[model samples]
Target: MHPDRYHVTLVLAGRPALHGWWGSEPIARAQFTGLVGRYGQPGTRITLVDEETGATLTEWPETS
Candidate 1:
């Protein structure tokens, strides 16, 4: 991970799903999408957050 890159936190129901840094938002979103595709549950809530700011970047299930 680069020091200048944004850190991403992937969570499912408040538990850590994945963690890493990405050079750009698109790459982070792509990573999030892939993770959900692999480990997402039918009713589970998955979220992507900006680790530095604690802001939610995205969520799974569209309506979640």
Candidate 2:
């Protein structure tokens, strides 16, 4: 079992606003997209990461 290997976080004003953990990446990715549409805004950040690999899978307001 993966055991919550995927993490989703929503940050606002440089503080943690929401957090989620899932054992599946697909589910976590879907939640990430939902969070962006629901809470996406200036000074807000949302990210999905694979905790097991320590890799950032995706983030809102993408960086160059």
Best by lDDT: 2
Q: Write the per-residue lDDT of candidate 2 for residues 10-54, one digit (tens) a residue.
A: 999899999999998888999999999999999999999998889
Q: Each candidate: RMSD to true structure?
A: 3.4, 0.8
47 in model 1: Cα distance from truth in Å? Answer: 2.1
Per-prediction count of colliding residue pairs?
0, 0
For each candidate in the order shown, give its overall lDDT on alpha carbons: 0.68, 0.94
Poorest lDDT segment (10 consecutive residues) of candidate 1 = 1-10
After best superposition, candidate 1 residue 42: deviation in angstroms?
A: 4.9
lDDT of 2 at 6: 98
Q: What is the lDDT of residue 14 in candidate 1?
A: 64
In Å, residue 26's CA in model 2 sits off its true spot by 0.9
Model 1 residue 63 CA deviation (Å) reads 5.9
For model 2, state the Cα shift of residue 62 in Å: 0.5
Q: Write the per-residue lDDT of candidate 1 for residues 1-64, one digit (tens) a residue.
A: 4442555555666677667777677887787788778867764666666666667778776663
